[model samples]
Structures are given as C-alpha cells and as structure tokens.
Target: MLAIETKQLSKSFWKNNVVKQIDLQVEKGEILGFLGRNGAGKSTFINMLTGILPPSSGSYALLGVQGPNNAVKKEIGVMPDYSSLYGSMTALKHLRYLSEVSGKKVSQSRAMDVLQLVGLEAHANKKAGKFSFGMKKKLAIAQAIVHDPQLIFLDEPTSGLDAESVIQIHRLIQRLHQQGKTIFMTSHNLDEVEKICSRIAIMKDGKIRRVGTMDELRAYYQSTITVTMKHAPIAATDLATLEPWLKQVGAQLEMEASHFTIQVESEQKIAEIIRALGSYKIDIYRVDVDEPSLEEIFLEE
Candidate 1:
C-alpha cells in the first residue's frame, strides 16, 4: 500500500502561492527525504499533509484514507519544526499525556521507557520549561513516537541539536526504521539525508523538482565531472605514454604533472577513462570522481 500520495496539492495565502501543484507518492517502508530552500513552502506543504492546515486546492490521501478526515490522524505521527510545551510539565508527564490523547494509556514505567529511548530518561522529572533547546526537540520526537504510529512526518529532527544530539537522534531514526515504519522527513543537511533516506524529493518554487534515490538525483544533474586520479607521482614524461592512450579514447588529460583530471560528461566516457588508465599499467593507487553532493544538486539551477 502507498504510504502517502498527493495530487495538485497546493496552498495560498492572500494570492501568494506558497505551495503549487505538487504530485508526490511514497511507498510503504520508504524513507523519503524532503528538501527545499527557505521560504520555498516546505513547511506549508508538510502542515497540509499532517492536517494542521488545509490545502487551498487539490487533495491528499494518507494510507489509503482520503481527507479532510480524522481517521488518518491516528495512523500518522508528526514532529513539527516547532512545538509548544508547558514549561511546568515534566518530560514524563508530556509523554503520558500525548499517549493518552493518541488513545493509548500506559503506565508511568512505559512513559519512562519512551523517555529513555530518546535519551531523556535522566531528566524525566525535570520540567520542559527548563529543558535545553536540544532537550525540547528530543521531547517533541518522543511524543511523536510514543504511540508508535505507522507513518511519521519529521521536519528537521536535528534542528537546534548539538553534534552529539544529532548522532543520538540518527540512531533513534534507525531504530524506528527497523520497526518497519514509513518516515517522511525534511532536512537542510544533505549529509544527514544521504546517510538515512531511502529516497529524496526536492522542492523548488513550491513544486517538486525531482524525486529519486541518490544515483537518480545525480543522473538528473549529471554533467561534466572532474575525475581526480591519485597514483605514484607522475613525471612530465609519463604524459607522453598516458596522454596518447587517453586521446585515443577521446579523454583529455589535464592539470599538474603528479596527477591528471578528466572532464567527463557521459557515463561511457568515465568508463573509457578508467579503461585507458588501467591499460597503461601506471602505478595507480586511487581515483576520485568529483561529483555533486546531494546539497549541490538541491542548489542547482
């Protein structure tokens, strides 16, 4: 079954089209990383999906249930970018209350277990008002998963978190995946997305630009690549034997004497470049292809 699906989903305020015709589909057990620049209507689109705000036009379905409906809400969990907490309430209290609201009633021990899962067990009795920014973010995540919903929407789960906290949250995300949950998350950190997401969908001008795995996204933006091969230091004389062979394969040799860079546009050219190098019998040690990272692809024009 599809986890989430949308068609021409859009939102506008006072004639400002925040979200445009966005047709997106996510499969069950898929981890989709949603990407967009600031002010690109990413939040608006997420809110619409999570039922916080209604779309001005179009429609969406969550787990085969159509909306505007409340039944789907129980099947989904949402960790919004910002959440309000009662500073006076303890972390344990927050979890229990959210669980109850989600139609599940658990003992205090269960609540503490959830807190421990988020690494906040030590501060269970501490009031959320006094919690650090990272702590509150953790609490938000804990609440979202307390019910163990089938599908979860996490917006910048690592925002406001320190390096250590980021690592901890990543592990938590992995744990949820192990339980076979579908996760749709948003993040500006391409490295983080690359590490955890099964697929990615990028938004630009309030519309989905592309959606695919790392290789698919790379292929969409694939252009000339700068191949940097590191081997035993090359003398100027090495170029004579190597350059001719490269030329034969329509590959160009460039840069300093110790190394060479090949400008590759197609995958076939890259293969030919490697073939030429292998045949030359040079003392090759390493070859590095300088391709665009996920971040670069998101920012591409």
Candidate 2:
C-alpha cells in the first residue's frame, strides 16, 4: 500500500515557482529520504503534502485518502523543520494538548510513553521554552507520533543534533518503520539519509533529478574509482615514463610527494592499470580504490 502519493504537485509564491510539477510515492513501511540542496523545494513539498500549505495546483493522497480531507489529516503526522510546540507549556502538557486535539483520547501515560520513546521523559515536566534545541526537536517529534499516525513527515529531524541525539533519532525512526509506519523525511545530510533511507529522491532546481535506491543512484551516476599508490618520488625526467601507461588506460594521475593517485572509470580497470605500471618497473607499495561519496554524486549532477 502506498502511504503517500503526489502527482503534478506544485506550489508558487508571488509568481515564483518553488515546487514544479513533482510526482512522488512512498509505500507502507518504507523510508523515503527526500534530499536536495537548500531552496530545492523539499520543505515546500512537505508543506504541501501535509496540508500546511495549499498547493497552487495538483493533488495528493495520504493512506489512500485524497488530500484536503480531514479524515486523512487525522492519520498523518508531521514534524516540521521548525519547532511548533508551545514554548510556555511543559513538555508533558504540550503532548497531552496535542493528543487531545488529535481526538485520540490519549492519557498522561501515553504522553510519557512517547516522551520515553524520544528519550525526553527525564525532562517531561520542564517547560518547552527552557529546552535546548535538540530537546525541543525531540519534543516536537514526540508530539508528532503521540497519536500513532500511520504516516510521518519529518523535516530535517537530525539537524542541529549532537552525535548521540542524532543516533537516538535515527533509531526512533527505524523503530517507527518496524511498527509498519511509512516515513518521508527531508535532509541535506546525505550520509544520514544514506544510512537510514530505503530509497531517496534527489531534487535540484525545484524538480526531482533522480529517485531510486542508493545502489541505483550510484550505478546510474557511475561513480569514479580513485586508486592511490605509494611509490618513491619520481624525477621530472622519469615522469614521462608513466605518461604512456596512464594514457593507454585513460586514467587521470595526480602525483604527490611520494604517492600517485589515479582516478579511473571503474574498479575493474584497476588491475589493467596496475599491470601497465608493473611493466615499467614501477614498484607498487600500496594500491587503494576509493568509492565515490554521496557528495561526489550530488556535485556531479
């Protein structure tokens, strides 16, 4: 079952199009990482999906129910990029109020349960205004899930969190997935998304440039393999000796003080490059091939 679906969804403000004809889908129990550079319309799209902002033109469905429907809204949860909790209210009160507004008949125990789930139970009685940014983020997340919504939208949930807090949030998200909730989250941190997301959509210029599993994105981009070799310093005169072998294999070589780095098209070509270098009597002390990181793929686009 698709927990979320959008078709030709778009939004504009003051004649400036922020989101342009986006189509996306998230299946039940799947975590879809919505990725983009800032101003790539990730937040705008989330706002539209959650009905926090009305789309200028388009349509969406949440859990098989069409958008702008109050029935659908009751089953959807959203943790925005900004904290929406009441500042003067205690964490416990804030959650209880939200649960009440959700019409779910949540008890104090249920509020504490979500607080514990988010690791904020120790500070439950503290006012939200006194909470640190990370703690407040946790509170907002706790409130979002208090109603046990089937689908959750988290916008930059790990942003501004310490390493431990980030891990806690990641684990909480994973646990939600285990409970069969669909998650759609936006983040500029590709590494974090890469670790937790089952699939990802890369957005650029207000349109989705690519959407697929990480392996699919990597394969589609054809990541470059960098091979580093430790060798004795080469004389200016001897540099020419390595040029022919490098040229024959179409490898780009960069020389450092005592090492050479060769970037090739793929890992399979490394053996041939090694053989070519061996034929020239170049002592190979070490060879390492580095795969491309997510940053590399984004920049290449």
lDDT of each: 0.85, 0.86
lDDT of 1 at 174: 87
Model 2 RMSD in Å is 3.4
TM-score of each: 0.93, 0.84
Among all candidates shown, the one with the greatest TM-score: 1
Clashing pairs in 2: none
| Segments in model 1 whose C-alpha atoms lie over 4 Å from true places | 233-238, 244-252, 267-271
Query: How much does candidate 1 score in TM-score?
Result: 0.93
Candidate 2 lDDT, tens digit per residue, 130-210? 999889999989988999999999999989989998999999999999999999999888899999999989998789999
